[model samples]
Target chain A: MDSYASTRLTRIRTAMKDQGLGGLLVCANGMRRDHVRYVTNLNVLGSWAIAVLGPERGPALFIEDPWDLDRARRDSWAESVTAGPGLLDGIVRAAGELGLRGPVGVAGMELMEAGLVLALRERLAPLTLQPATRLLVELRLLKDEGELRAIRRASELADAGYEVFLGTARAGLPEYELVAEIEGFLRDAGAEDNMMILASGGVEVTGMRPPTSKRLQVGDLVTAELTPQVNGYYAQICRTLVIGEPSAAQQQSFEIFWQAQEAAMESARPGVTISQVAEAQNEVFRKAGFGEYVSKRYTRARGHGLGLHFDDEPLIWEGNDLRLQAGMVLIAHPNTYLPLAGYMVLGDPLVITDGGCERLTKTERRLFAVAP
Target chain B: MKRGLVEWDRQELPEGAFAARLAACRAGMCEERLDALLVYTDVWRAGHVRFLSHYLPYWSSGLLVLPLEGEPLLLSTQPQRVFPWIAETSLLREVRAAPALGKAAAAVLAERGWRRAGVVELQELPWGIYADLTAEAPGACELVDASALMRGVRLSEDGHEEALLTKAAAMAAAPLAALDPVGQRDWAVIATLERAYRRAGAEDLMLLVTSPTAGQWPGVPREAVLADGVLLQASLEYKGHWLQLSRTWLPAGASPLRGLYDRLGRAYAELSETARPGLSEAEAAGLLKRLAPGDGLHLFAAHASGSAPFTPLPGLDGIEEGMVVALHLGAEDRQGHRALVGDTFLARREGLARVTT
Candidate 1:
């Protein structure tokens, strides 16, 4: 195993021991893979996968799709890998073989299929099953050097995707077609996956959604959150642009978002609560007499942690008490509705440092304008 | 994950089709004595809900509540601000932003006084959602598995669905047909294909590459020089329908595996020819065994395909008309040389018609 995998395994094993778990069954799917990836370093592609890790023996990876067996064996750090017609059955058999008769923790249990969980409980018998989703989340709360490298690369790709978006957004272009251009560029540039959502309109647009057939018109505020994943790590960059020259109202509305994002990022330091960071952003809107827009009625999170999953821990929102720690990676975006000019987004991916935070996204924090 | 084009084509999938689908689902619910049927959708398994509502979530999850005799409602994790877009893109008029999908669904059931509720793919429902739902209602509601009912409803494709599948198959085959893997890097080839798929408006895709001789399993593209005897398997979704196609690339020369490739092609042809509406699973397996009778053959041969979460051919009784299936045939020779070929086919009364050529 590489140093990165070795370090991760060591940490996971230590956590398992501390939790009084005899074994760990890490589950993942295409949608939620951080748990399994953190345990086995495998990028799952099938419907679902499970990594059976014991105290004495190494981890054994099991995937549902037989076609994915070879890939899982090749990519995963686990010594024993099996592809199955029945993923849960394979997990049960592996657990028995590993002699795990005590309480076994199953990460991502909440996200797992209910029937499978029930079957596992019945089959495992005396071996109790425990929910370990929080355990995995706490382990992945901080970014290590290897993870930082991947996140930095993903941030770079997000920047490149934004450039592609800026170059492709034009009047008369369909929203889907514009997304296609950005996706193509990102894939060609070595991004395996991206979570992108865009919206193009004037004040009528409330927020970004999956690309639609609506055509971009002049003076439309095209907003997008371009998050690209590289090496199983994700970084995001949210920005808004105008198809034509920005209007005075659009510019004025965008400045507030920029300021809010800046304040949030500045407040993102070690020992600061995520709610404080979110309050900093909301305070900007409050000073501008748009405080209501910061609530859930008009917007979601001010920002969120970006990692293997698009929305990770320390989600920057009011009332979230998770503290910012050094080595934690997150994005602080003041993306919300502006009465003067639709929803505007201006955010950057940054990593919390000992003193403050370091910005990973190099995109200029401003309202970009594409020539009509 | 599906960052590519994701727009509802009103002309391709009209409102009438969604209405028909909802009506069919309600008909099934009525027959099953179900007050309401719930279809959960996420990025990975959105076929059931998308089929009935044309609402494929970009992220998070959603629930489609189909009452026996009322307008269907959609509860999504997306905020209410994006409901207008959801309404515009889908046939759903009542779209509620439910952060907790199961809780919201449970509340909806309670509000409607629904007692007998059926959940499609009940086994696959997330444990958290299931707990929330069952906990919220306790013994007041009864949830039953409706996977078979849903499957029966989706087994036969409509004309519009077939057209979408045909288009998706063609799109999947386009890049493979144009690929020149000779002297090209593996990642470059994959990147080129991905670009093509996205440019053609694919919503999502899964591509794997393999070299049979190197004892390597089919895997995501890595940085390696591509040579002769490489296999590429691609499954791409257009709009909401999925189609799979596999091809083995070989340099033109006196290759040792030419005979194997030819034999595999013949087996695929024969399998396609023999697969009809009434073909039984045993008969299909027997035909495959006779065509490529050996211990080196891969166990997985065929599966029903048309939407996300393609069902394997084991639990299903047999092939039927209008059913789209993807057949894969692969075997290894005594010298360790291996060849695999596959194509998506549409089962008809006469015979199977190849959808991906």
Candidate 2:
């Protein structure tokens, strides 16, 4: 048995044993298949899967198509991973192979369709099925060292991309055009996945998005939101800037956000629940009389998990109480925009540590002016 | 005269508006009575889904099942949080993880105790999802295709949607016009183009550009001057709307480029000729082909853009009156190189119409 497969099998075994589950099948379906990729190193976009952590013996990684068997052989170290249709049949067929049968726990079971669920019920007339969320969440929340490194790399590249963005901002530029340049730079800087949203129209403000052809005037509030992916790991960095000369109000807004951002950064630490992070931001905004914006005009928790998908679990919202743990990468931002009040954007990628949090990027969080 | 993209009233689309479209699909399903109509979409299949639901599904693939009658149910994956942002009608919904999609679907139908239901576009369903659905479906119920159901309503373009697209298409050139050429780097051209599209108020745009040399393979911008003789090809999209166009200028002499351009340009009748309902897709292709001079495939024009891209969106949606389309059929042969002429087109009920003619 390969090392990682054993590691996965052991974890699955523990999960089934812990949950009193007979079996737990993990899958990546639609946009949710990223987990399968995270575990197996196989980025199957077409909903491939693995049935792991059967109560008795262990688990089996299953692929939808037989064509991927060799890729599985080359990439996956699992000994019993197999291919083809009727995974439920495979689950039944491999029952003895797994050395356990009764009370199987299926994560994706309820999510199945009407007719198929009925048919599967007939097929699995003997066994039992439980909800898949808790088991899957258990496997996902714990990040391995390799995963941590990949996320760190993605974050560093994001910061470098921001540096390029700061250096490139100038007058007579369009919002989308600026983003394209940054995208091009990020691509060159070894970024594999990216979701960029930027905006820079000052007169009538709304929010941020991917750069548009809206030309940057002398005082346009250029906002760039970037998420760079390192091998499927997402790292987020958002920054706001001014075109040409910076206005006094813009400068003031930038400083306030800068202070607020530093405050939030300082507040992040291991053992602290995610709500603490939100509280830090809320404390800043509440001190400024923006307390009424909680869950309304402006959200209190703008921070969240930035992982496989740019936004992941454990959101930095008002009520979320997940504690910060080592190896968990979070995007902490205290972003709030009130109409006629200008912008307040402060966010950075951070990895939880034994004591405090470490920023993935070292770029200064102060508002910058575009050079001529 | 323009407005911001996101600033528009999302209510312009409204909740009940889609129900009518689905109801129309159900009417077609009843024509043969499909077990249920299956409309499938993934991150890759979002464009097709967007054609029905304004929400674009963001990243997850979604399935909307509408029976001949009764409430329609939408099934999708977990982390499937974006549904509400796009779902206005009570009709939209979500399923669990992707694995048991079939089983869940069957259970839903069996609970209803329906005997026969029709599905549309079953071919596009993911194989795993399909297999699971087939395996788990109630033995008493039947599943089949009713493609005619959705196709019946798919041809008609909505009023507000057309307005939004028209406004978006007009933006194709808005940023281009505002771009300053001097002292700008190669990436500046791309940036300028994006700004042009954004300033023009496009919702979600996918603009791809390449100088003549980069055609074989794609390349980033170079420090090249945007002067007269540059053959630039730009593929533009707004709100997942796809349009292709090309524009070129002749620094040497306007006569040759203009002369060659006039031949293809004739097909691009702005207000004089508009694509209406009766015009078959083949006829529009023929008109574009005629501009090509020999069966409509070759070096006369580099590219053209609209619904199906160089080829219009398939099905019965030919040039219909009141529909907006891009008429990018122009060329410049000053240096004997192919010309890139791209523009927009609008279809009117009576006379020919062109929005950015």
Candidate 3:
């Protein structure tokens, strides 16, 4: 096993021992399978997969599709990989063979249909099933050396997407076409996936989404939340660009958001609560007399954690008391709505260090303008 | 990757279309003596809800509580955050935030006095919520499986849906027309094709690449150099409809696999020829076994397409007029030669029509 995998397994085992859990059941279906990916480095893609990690038996991978059997064996660190007609039966058999007793920790239970979980509970009677959501989140909160490298690569891809945006965002092209260009560039650069929402129109644009066929006009403001995943690690960078010279109102709104982002990033040091980072940015809007727009309706979280998942944990929102720790990666974005300029986005990923935070992305924070 | 509950279209579907779908669903519920229909959706499978209402679920699990007499209610964990998104994407008027979906659904049943309710994919529901719902309703409500009802109702496509599928298929195939495939990495080719499809209005695109060098049927793309011969599978989802096609790339000088491609093409043609509206599942399976060269583990040779692909597998009831199905034929030899060719087809009384040329 690689050093990273060894270290992560050790950490997970330690946590499992502390919680008095004999075996951990990690189930991943169509969505939110980060726990399985975190432990096994295996992606089920469109199907469902489960991993059973035991104190004595090590790891065994279970999948529904036969095609994934080869993939799991080839890509995963699991000692044994199982796939066939009776997948659920295989899961039950594996649990028994692993000799799991007492209460078992289950992750990704929220996404599992209630019927499946109930059935599993009935079949695996005498063993209690408890939510290990907190346990998994705690394990993935810190960024290790390998994870840091992957995040850095993902952030670089986001920057490359921005460069594509700068080159392609112009008048006459449809907004979706620009999406194609930006995502195409990132994908070509080895990005596994992209979560992008782009909106381009006059100053009064309402929101962002997957690019529509709406044609861009001169002086339109384009705001995009470019998030690209590299090796399952996601990094997001939000930027707003003008088709031509920005209006005075647009420039003013940009200045306020830029200052807010800076303030938010400045307070992202270790030992500080994430709410403080949010307060610093929200304070900017309040002082500028735009405090009413700081609500959730007008904006998403000021920023959130970035790692295996796009929006991880410790939401940087007002009054949240989750303290910052060294090795926690966050995106300090104060992407909010403005009456003058509508919705504008600007932010970058940062790594919390002993004294301060290190910016993961090197893209410029200025209000970009594309010449007509 | 799993599908997400996010609308790629900035505009909502026509109000009349949504109304027609709801009317069809209500008719189904009425036929089964169900007072209300509960459609469960998540990030992975949001098609049923998206069919009745254009709104897509995001982050948390979602449910559409459609009563026989009253307006439909959308239950979500974060109604406020999802309100504008739903408003922008759907025609539904009522939405409620419910932390506990089962209790919330039970309450809806209680409020409407819905004694006979139907739940689609009941087995997929979480046990905890199922327990809470049963506890809350006790003997007041009886839940029946509505999966068949929903599937039968949506098996055939309307005119608008057919047009959307055709357009989506064209968009997905546009990138292949320009791909030379030589001297390029798998990632580069996928990236290029994904860009073209997404820009042309594909909400989600799934690409699988394989080659003779790789013994696997569907191979993951990496930094490996492209082989002289390769098979590319592209599946595109647009406007809640799915379109899938596979293309084989070969150089002009290659004649060794000419017979293989010819046989694969004939298999597709033969399947299309025999796929009539009234064809039984057993008859279709027999025809495939008699004509096809390779074995299909689950009869994936020709499967129905929708929000998800090849769902409900292919049964006697699955074949119908105006049904859109994907024809994916795979052949292999003991010598490790593998070939797969697939595209979307429109089933007609006469025969079949290829939607993605």
Candidate 4:
């Protein structure tokens, strides 16, 4: 109906044609759900779902929950929304109605249960089911105007969460209470969901989880990765705070990561490979005599793509040579464990532009020293 | 020299509680003639894993392998970077940082020389991983669906689980006592509940807020100025057990729900009285339908709640003693005013006792 929806369908159809797919069974679970949301514009509340799309005919969305059927019809661009108390039957019905005969593409199959796929194979005999995960990921690689708007809003909410973190990280406050305060601020600011991990201690901290009853002590280093989702688009911001005056070793440990993150951002220009950006940060660590700590032993990832899902394609890590393209949003952080300061976190969301990139979050990046 | 949330600690199951669960699981494995049991869980469905192993995985996928005899192993996709946090929260001894699930599971089975293995809820496992396992360890081990075996052991709440459920219900109910509807928004109300629940040791929460204008349906928290009468409902999961809570904020004037709440409260009381060891699920459903006759009742009037959400729905067989159940009741007047009440009840041979108030 709308031009944007038409454009999206056309782009997907082109991909389907290129892949020799007459129909595409786009599956989404709680883990890999951006594809269905991208095509249907409906953020599925259920755990798993599928969208049956034909190159010529309109798409049919199959949802697990009956209550969600009404919401899907209202919010989704798909012309048909069917309730699938059992998803396999819904898929069969959609395929029959759409008359999709020939090779069918299945996306997000990794998240799909093995039994479901086997059932589909048995039920839809003679129809070839091919992997279409890459097609969907490529389509979502670049952000459109509407997606950018949602990502901007999500990033702003994450910034608001950081502000709350700054104000609440004080001595004697339990970690979970501070987590509650930040989460409360985000929810009140219209964040639909959030995944925040935080840990606070004096150099003995390992990582963060949902706020616990552990109270903060003076001179504690509080590190948190605050990822808030608004309208299904997630923007992540990782920041660290000191409960009181920071020690010399603590400040120095934070500076290493701050400089590394800056180096990564400098190489995040369009047309530059993601590995180049990672190399820039890894070089910083190596120069500082912390080269050995840059691997997975010390950090999970140097950074990763940010969008509807927390980690998208073109993950910014060593050996990943995917080139950076304009409109691709990323949360680049060189958060690693330091010998003296433990695990310190400092990262922000930014979007690749035609030239360089623009930071989406406005929270200050320097080590925040909260008053006791 | 000191800075931390020292008092803040994860709500852990007592060591004896874990030992009991392991004993029960091993007994089930023995009865089923299985050498090992593999339980897979993601964020959505994790009660099975959390019930046996004290590991509450939030972000990624995890597998808990319990052999017929030996220490259980936690196969975590998270890197060694999070091993410390995992160790702090879980009771599993050997936590293997496994990126590839199928390979890791196959290796464990091969190492233990397990010939027969049971997979809990085969329908829930990813096909890719199953294919990989079949390819990797063909004939090395035989896998069977043991979901029924797990359900038999975890359908009822143990003493420790019951205690956690009681605590979760109280935490979910605290924010409703003083919710000011005059100027609060829907998200603000939800925020209040989230904060209170987390502070009171809630691990997971599914909250919904609605009003006369918004209609009575669960949804994400949005900015809507609360009207005189607003309904706040939640299904809180605390330390792996669940309970339901619903409260209404009435304006100063006379409200239609004033009578409805009393009627629903009576229905809950009546259901608690009639619910016993021998009462069938259909019989309980009949009693709830007859007592709390209304237009706004969900699909199930009463169902099992511990470990899994609504395991045995209405029309099922008899309810067993020691089973934790969530009783949901609601009513709507002709003028569109609605009153909803839900709570967790433990069915015992002596009688039914409400755990969540």
lDDT score, residue A209, model 3? 58
Candidate 4 per-residue lDDT, tens place, B136-229, comes to 7647688899988887778645877776776676776677676685457888888887777776666767777767444444466567887656
Worst 10 residues of 1 chain A by lDDT: A65-74
lDDT of each: 0.81, 0.57, 0.77, 0.76
Regions of candidate 2 where Cα sits further than 4 Å from its true position: A1-9, A47-73, A77-96, A107-121, B1-45, B53-148, B151-357
- Cα lDDT of model 2 by residue, B33-110, tens digit: 565666665544444345555434444455666666666566665333223334432335543434355666777778
Q: List the residue pairs that clash in candidate 1.
A: none
lDDT of each residue in A1-372, candidate 2, tens digit only: 556556766786777787777766555554455556555665442334655545655446676544245455555544467765567677556765766555766665433333444454577667665556656665766677766877888888888889888877787865655665666566445554477766675634544433445567777777776888776778888888777777777776566566667777788887888887877777776676656543434433568787776777777876677878887778788776644335456688888887888898877778777765
True contacts kept of each: 0.60, 0.04, 0.44, 0.53
Query: Highest TM-score: which candidate?
Result: 1
Model 3, span A83-163: residue lDDT tens: 755667877888888888768888887666676688788888888888887888987889899999999999999988898
Model 4 per-residue lDDT at A144: 86
lDDT of 1 by residue, B94-207 (tens): 888888888999899889998899999887889889888878853677989998788778865678888898888878877787888756766667777877887788888777
CAPRI quality of model 3: acceptable
Residue B161's lDDT within candidate 1 is 81
Model 1 Cα lDDT, one tens digit per residue, A235-324: 999999998899999999998998898898878899999999999999999999998999998888899988888888868888999888
Candidate 2 steric clashes: 65
User: DockQ (Cα-based) per candidate?
Assistant: 0.59, 0.06, 0.43, 0.42
lDDT of 4 by residue, A164-257 (tens): 8888788888787777787778878888888788888866665555566778989888889888898789999999888889899999999899
Q: Which portions of model 1 miss their true places by more than 4 Å? A: B138-140, B210-214, B276-282, B293-295, B299-307, B314-322, B333-338
